[model samples]
Target: MSITLSIIYLISTITFVIGLKLLGHPETAKKGNSIAAFGMGLAIIGTIFLNNLEVPIFIYILIIVAILIGSVIGWLIAIKVEMTKMPELVSLFNGFGGASAALIGIVEYGNNQADITQVTTIIAAIIIGSITFSGSMIAWAKLNGSLKKDIRLPKYNLINNLLLIALIVFGFFIVNGSINGEIIIYILLLFSLIYGILFVIPIGGADMPVVISLLNSLTGIAAAITGILYDNMVMMVGGILVGSAGLILTFAMCKAMNRSLSNVIFGAFGGDSVAAKKGSTIGGHIKKTNPSDVAVLMNYADKVVIVPGYGLAVAQAQHVIHELEELLTKKGVEVSYAIHPVAGRMPGHMNVLLAESNVSYDKLIEMDDINPQFKNTDVVLVVGANDVVNPAAHNDPSSPIYGMPILEVEDARSIIINKRSMNPGYAGIQNELFFNQKTSMLFGDAKETLTKLVQELKNM
Candidate 1:
């Protein structure tokens, strides 16, 4: 590597590492984000200056238009989207990444499939990217509530494996053969895309975090291949960092749920004999409460913690929740936001949503940080969250969600949940916490419920 390229790589790597570290802390998250963005900017500048790749004016024009469109849409989302809905938006962004990678592969094949050395990378990129794109889209749809939140597919282990094998066999011919048919690559790409969507379809909603993490890893692999194609050191490094981080997260998610990564990958969960023996045989009995009663409970509490979820996203109520937090803080009640790693549909879903509402990053506490505090918390206000706060994670071995690490919300002195109804979370399992004597279900739109609570506090 040239001196300049090496230096740039080192700088970019440092920024990403530090940025990720800061992001983990919550308190330093803003600075961490700035650092990461700056690092990306610097790398882009370096790429532009390398003076090697000749770009047509039209391509530059395309970049300009893309930037304009992206900036406008991003700004609108930043301005208008509720914190709860951020997870789905992230899924969409992930789709963009995966689709871009796949398209690059398609373009590359059209331009240079005659060469043998390039074929492998090209095929790999296409496979990884298409799958990521389609899978992420499905995940986004689920998180956004744009699609039905159900495990829509039955177990099909044999068929799924055969499809993969077929894809592999087709991939071998496409990569090894020269200059005959680009149609094969297209067919393979389409199959991979469909497979990606199907891959996540059988997964119960409760496993979204794991799905998102795995998809992230796929996108990283695609980026890395693209980097090799272009001989871009910074891109390669970034891809490696993202890929490794995603894998680690995937493992962590599996461990948190007391699940094996293999089980998650293979879609054999529902039929498991162990599932009957160990799953969370939770409740079909769900109860509902209102906001004013919840407010009274909150007013009496010495301390309160708010748990947010995908339901909150669908309602777009982060701002109102922020208002509730501010009210709690003024009344001398301690207020903190408990964030679950996979609470919504993606990683950092809650964080970005809260940030969009201008919620102080310091107020957000991670699952690890907040679990201990729950015991001392007078009330746990669960806003549209189900699976994460369900006691079934600990008590039910027969449940599909059995053994997953969940917030010990049941440990709190009292708990209040706001949701549409007794709807099962993405995992299709009942939340047992609603039956707890200390737990009260608050049924309404999350936004409306929180608004009523805010009003009740004012009346107090």
Candidate 2:
């Protein structure tokens, strides 16, 4: 690479690091993304203009056209996508990254330009990239409700293990030139695609967050392998950063859920249709309350903490919830949010949703920080959250979510939960918190109920 290109790569790498650091907080996330995007743009331009490659003008035109098309489509998706669908969109985008990496490997392999090291990297890219792409698509489907049931074959674990072993052995053979036929490479691709499907299909809705994180990390690893194949500094640095960050996040989420990576993969813990079947009756009558009652309760409370879940996003009630928070704050009630790490469909889902509605970042407290505060809280309002706040995680050993850390809202003086119906949450199990003595279920759409409660507060 030319000195100018090298300098551009260095700048890009620095921006990526800085941007990732900024992403640690919601307040600077948007700015961090913009900075990283700018770095990527610079790297692309530098590669096209500064790299002394004898590429044809037509090829350059084609590349430019592809970039334009992809950018336009991505922008449209960003603008049109609802917050509820953000997780699916993220899954799709991760898949695209994997697909791109896989294509790079395939093209390089066919070019006959690879040494043994390059060959090894190429095969690794193909396997990991194919898995990432296929697995992400499955995750998207599940998130969008297209695939509602977890489909597991008899002896699926053995099957999956065999497929994985085969893939590793095949990839090794290809790298060593023991496999010389084009058909062999194509077979490897087919097996990889199948393995990806099998890998994700058995995973239930409850573990979707961890699966997404794991697939994202795989995509990054594939990108890094591709970068190694091409000796591209920017791509290598960026890929390593993404891969490591994603891996760390995946492990963290698993820990939060009190499940190991092996368990998440093979356990199939929370199957959608079967979860309700697996649930034992936490027999207690639920007390239903109206919006007026909830508003009156909050009005008297000194400190209030709101817990948001996927239902909040589903109803597009983020802004309304923020309005309620502000009203309570104006009334001299200390308001904050209790954010469970695995609360929503993805990591940081609650924080992002609340932030979009202009909620103060300071009011958003993580599970560990907020759990202890619940005992001192005057009232706890759970908006569309279920599994994260479910007492089964603490008291019911037979429950699928047993031993998982929860918000401990039951410790509060009063509990008001808003939900559209008595339907179970994503885990497909009834929440025992709803039946707690101090808990009152406020039944209605989150947006409508929260809006009414806000109006009631104003009337008071």
TM-scores for all candidates? Answer: 0.82, 0.93
lDDT of 1 by residue, 1-460 (tens): 4568668767987898888789777579899999998998777656555545678978778876886898799779777865555556666778889999999999898888766768778888888899999999898876555666445454566666778787777778887783248677789888999888778776655567688888888798899888888777767778878898889989987876678888887754543453454325444555566787888988999999999987887788989999999988999999999998777666577887888788898899999999999999999989888888877677766666777778899889988988888766666566768888888888889998889999999899
Off by over 4 Å in 2: 25-31, 271-279
lDDT of 2 by residue, 307-365 (tens): 99998998999999999998999899999999999878987888878889999889999
Measured by TM-score, the strongest candidate is: 2
lDDT of each: 0.80, 0.89
* lDDT: worst 10-residue window of model 2: 271-280
Worst 10 residues of 1 by lDDT: 270-279
Candidate 1 scores a C-alpha RMSD against the true structure in Å of: 4.0
